[model samples]
Target: MQVMEPVQMALPVTLPDDETFASYFGGENSLEVSHLKSAFDSLATTFQYTYLCGLGDSGKSHLLYATCIHAQERGLSTMLLSMREVIDFGPMVLDGLDALDVLCIDDVHLVAGNDAWEKALFNFFNRFNEPGKCLVVTADLLPDMLNISLPDLESRLKWGTTFQIRSMSDDDKAEALVKRANMRGLELSDECARFLLTRLSRDMRALLDVLDKLDHASMAAQRKLTIPFIKSTLQL
Candidate 1:
């Protein structure tokens, strides 16, 4: 069995905004996030809702964002709505469902935090019907486990292709780190990438923080990235 390490000293991870997702980690055809890609590709053809399920930092949001980009590039209209953001806007956002060909709602569990929101979601989804239109929802857990008070809404959430984000293997993460770093116009050596994987938590978001720190350190020191610089600065 693989041993999990505790995260390094860092603040809780913040989800990247749409721009950051697009700029930092564009999807690759051969990337190891294939589980997510296969499920979403099926959704593209079928116009069906798909749930991206995973534990925190399993890269669910990133995969969903990539799906949106892919959909847009195919000339399909797409909108990303965060459940946390929707809660503050009331149900008007829900009523405007006809505005897009695909709607992706992130962090659906936030609706479970309140009764009114769940009721609104149930009502909205019940009336939302458009031929060839799709809805994708992401949650920290499966719909059955979302703790939603509305049985109907809960059922609808569970009523689709559920794509769970696969946790990264050491090699998988090393590739991802190198890919993301390259997007930022930097080179990440295998040694530095593997060292980060060994010394840091396996959570991708936590791993991002380490990368961000290294980005700053590299810039501040005016040097190309090397494992020794990381070891000295991160004290690992």
Candidate 2:
């Protein structure tokens, strides 16, 4: 049997204006959200390194982007780097990042088992040891659980605070969909939101993508989001 390499997802490097603390629904991960907010609010955080681990669509990327946006709002130089986007660019892209007030990296587990990337990351960690520099990383797994090749890098990942963002319950998910639709200037009814939850993938990101489609369909048809309309538009 031939084993295929994991295909990295190409996420946009720019933080979407919609991705902010107010936009996020913490659900079971409220403490994690608070920690991220504090880290972004203060230049001198008690923990210089913060590692967030959670399954995809568990709001890990949301908090990371929120942190970047919050920091930028506070007049801090911020960069929201996606490892999946920059893994192809080589580790040289990590150079000159230590000067930033806040540096946030997403999908960091994508570099597991790569020697060059690990070395560069290890060196970057060492170089970013200044008192007020903050480095926040997100991955699908905890640092120790990742199949990292470099022990030094692995150890460095655990040097500071680590938190796991929890998946929301079904009720919370339904509320979140409605809230997101409201933010988009659309009204997503409770019944319609529940219908989507039952039919679509449980992943928040996937559900949000479907919501985008529904938003366009509703506008084009000049229709409210009725269950029948959703069924016809999405063929559910």
- Tell me each candidate's TM-score: 0.70, 0.84
lDDT score, candidate 1, position 71:
61
Please list all clashing residue pairs in model 1, or write none if there are none: none
Compute the lDDT of residue 22 as modeled in candidate 2.
82
RMSD of 1: 9.5
lDDT of 1 by residue, 111-219 (tens): 8857778888777666644445667778888888888887888888977767666555678778778887887777898888988988889777788778888888999
Q: Determine which window of 10 residues in candidate 1 has minimal summed lDDT.
A: 2-11
**Taking the tens digit of each residue's C-alpha lDDT, what string does model 2 give over 1-236?**
12222222225633335767787887324787777776644546543679998875678788877777777666667777899888999998987776776788898999999999999999999988776678889899999899999999999988878998777778878988898899999999999999999998987777888888999999999999999999999998
Best by lDDT: 2
